[model samples]
Target chain A: MTALIAGAASTTFGKHDDLSARELFRDAAEAAIGLVSLTAVDIDAVYVGNFMGALTDDQGHMGALMADYLGIPDVPTATVESACASSGTAVSRAVDAIDAGQADVVLVGGVEMMYATGIAVITDALANAADNEYENEAGLTFPGIYALMAREYMNTYDVSEEDLAQVAVKNRRNGVSNPISQFQEEVTIEEVLEARPIAPPLGLFDCCPITDGASALIVVSPEFAANHGLSPDVRIAGRGQAGDTLALQDREDMGRTRAAERAAERAYTAAGIVPEDIDVCEVHDCFTIAELLAVESLGLCERGEGATLTTTGETAKEGRIPVNTSGGLIAKGHPVGATGVAQLVEIVKQLEGRHPNQVPDSAIGVTHNVGGSGASAVVHVLEVAG
Target chain B: MTASWYESFAAAVDREEPQYRRCAACGESGLPPRQTCPTCGEPEMIDAPLSMSATVVAATEIHVTTPKFEGEAPYTVVIAEFDENVRLTGQLSGNEDVRPGDGVTVGVERREDWPPVITFTPS
Candidate 1:
């Protein structure tokens, strides 16, 4: 039987001043669990996706911590960490558990509190996602990796820095209506162009901030959901994940993310849906350049056409296919582990007509989450129940 | 072992320079170490220095360094495809105009806390 996402919730995606990781998870979990007629007791298992609680907050065993804090200590719990795709992977696992009859209801939560750490600590923490002996040893930061891809994209496609800036400007505009977004102020093309460079081609504005937040979702089998007096508006029609070599140099194409393509293929095949079937999508846009690449990797557009779509405003909210209605990581803020689940939350809200930045006539939605450069990726397709 | 940057890289070089495993099944060179071949998933392998020279596949300039290495602000990192078909990512040295397909040779350079990192210089 297929799994249904009965409810979802997320803390505002930004740096929160007063919330602990436990508090953040509590808020999101409470909101999600409250939305359903069933309580936490009904959840047969709990999955937590957190990448850096150990180094950043000196907290490990996050699964037990959250389970205990939420008053569900006896439940089977596991922590899933696939770098930035942690929470998205958690969702995939939840679906599998339900399909295998291991659990009828599952609580999946993703949380990250990155702002508490120093910049150096965070950099090291993030670097752990790459090939330690190769990339990290060579002093390659995450921005540096994406910057290489951006430069290659620019050189191969004749895409100018101005074209890249358009992505930031467009997402910022979408952020205006997203109250949870860290950057609600709209940015002009000129501002993006003038923003201080973080990596030569990628400026400070091009990157997402280190955020502290959490997102929670309640996943149940369709029959289980219906039996519990819950009617889900979003059903998981398809889910897929793929992994590639940790080193970027190992891949045949530096500009393309093969893992994303593989995952998308499986997702589309499973759902019997094509790129055209998706009305909106929430993609991994930790950097502006990533958003561009995601467009192509997800098959929304052809290779080298991502920048073109952005330049033509085809990715804008009012355009043919809206992308990142949550304002994306660039504006919505990326809390790492929480980001993937947050993406699903945004898509669910859009389908249920509860999205603050809702796109008209939206039916099918997709979420793409990538872990560390393109080593891992998970894609999910959801349909709005009639 | 000394903790200096050059010493660290020297240690890395010494450790890496040996009968390296190239998955006979997949033809991809395994770096550091691997339990199974990533490409073909075969366990059998052959020993082969991944070419000391490689062609730059991609390059970028990091305007801001990690706070730990803030002194090295504005350095270039490049991914080079070694002759063995294994890609290696490292700092690119010499002219800032490095581009894809440019030939480069691996070199060692000292850093603040770590030893000489394996860097690349335009060949």
Candidate 2:
């Protein structure tokens, strides 16, 4: 089973002017399909990754909606939801389908139009990802869950508030060059430090904006691509996913994400590459502290070294190992379901040497997308092979 | 978004105030009830009344406030760990001079929609 990513595309990730949820998905799908040699009818199936279309737009059955709009009415379609990693999971499933010889070509898309919903509704929608009986019933929102981790990380690692603020400053600075990012302006550490507080130790700037966007990717077997007169830019060498307890309290350790560690390990093994082999990474930086933890969890840095890396510019675009070169969720905007696919879109561009904010000569790129305070993690490693 | 638990708990405690659950097994208490003994995993949890008294385990002052809690800018949030490993996190109460391991207590403060959060007051 030879699997390769033939094409990828995403809308600029801020709140769009007049796009509906279906339109957002359709536009991204069109962009991806246009780049590939195959038409909508050639695709075997459609997989949509969306978390809150039902509550946010009164639109469920997203798979059917996208397939119908794209004129692939008879193809099988399904929507996957695993919090923010929904699209990543969708991509994983598409890869599986091709690997299993079940599909020759698949269209994987992720979209979220969160701006249409109010704050309370959005909060409720996100809260649905948590343990309904345990965490959500107790008034624990997503921010509150990460807040607990931030506090624990600070206590155990002695990471200062200033260090966490540096993450927001750095990611926003990276966002400045990203045309699709929601925030184009660079922010200062001082500004981040002084921003209004959402949860304790986490300010408004520390949290990712409720973004509206969609991203799509065309995954085909390498054999199929060759037979169809298509060129493969990047090979999906490694993909791994792991799930943990939904409630943060269920974890034995608060500072570490076990699911991330396990997924990264499996991905590296499957790709036959070590962490040092990765030239670039697109991680789940839904929160500033999350980026810090991701660096550590992905083995880019040792535990407790993430803050130091951010503070010293090690994770900067030109630094030793550039993380979140796509502005991350911080400034890139997080349309939960769209985030994972967006990460892959950026990485594929980097591998294809097409990224505007390209990491010079990036050969091996990895993406890590997590859901609900690290309850679920999907890690995929991609490489450019001639 | 009114405080359903706040009014009922305050009425039960009969002090015009909110209360937390205490582990009948360990005597540890928090605003949001703990299900099992965090230290021992004992299921002998019971409702225990608590006062706004605790010490800050870790504290950071937040300047940016979200739309839901806009007026409370520059508020302090602290992770307050009590005896028996029962830890609670909330905004700091009183004059926000908080530090790790500083003794503190809980303070009843209303947010926009929910019941009063378990704010921390320096003990």
TM-score (C-alpha) between model 1 and the true structure: 0.94
Q: Which stretches of candidate 2 lie over 4 Å from their true place?
A: B1-123
Candidate 2, position A7, lDDT:
81
Q: Which candidate is the best by lDDT?
A: 1
lDDT (Cα atoms) of all candidates against the true structure? 0.85, 0.81
TM-score of each: 0.94, 0.82
- Where does the lowest 10-residue lDDT sum fall in candidate 2 chain A? A131-140
Per prediction, the TM-score for chain B is: 0.75, 0.62
lDDT of 2 by residue, A40-148 (tens): 8899989999999988888899999999999998998999889999999999999989988889899998999888776667877887787653444334567767877
lDDT of 1 by residue, B1-123 (tens): 343533544455546552346877867676545547877788876657556788988887777666656787678888877777667778877656787888988767766756456788898
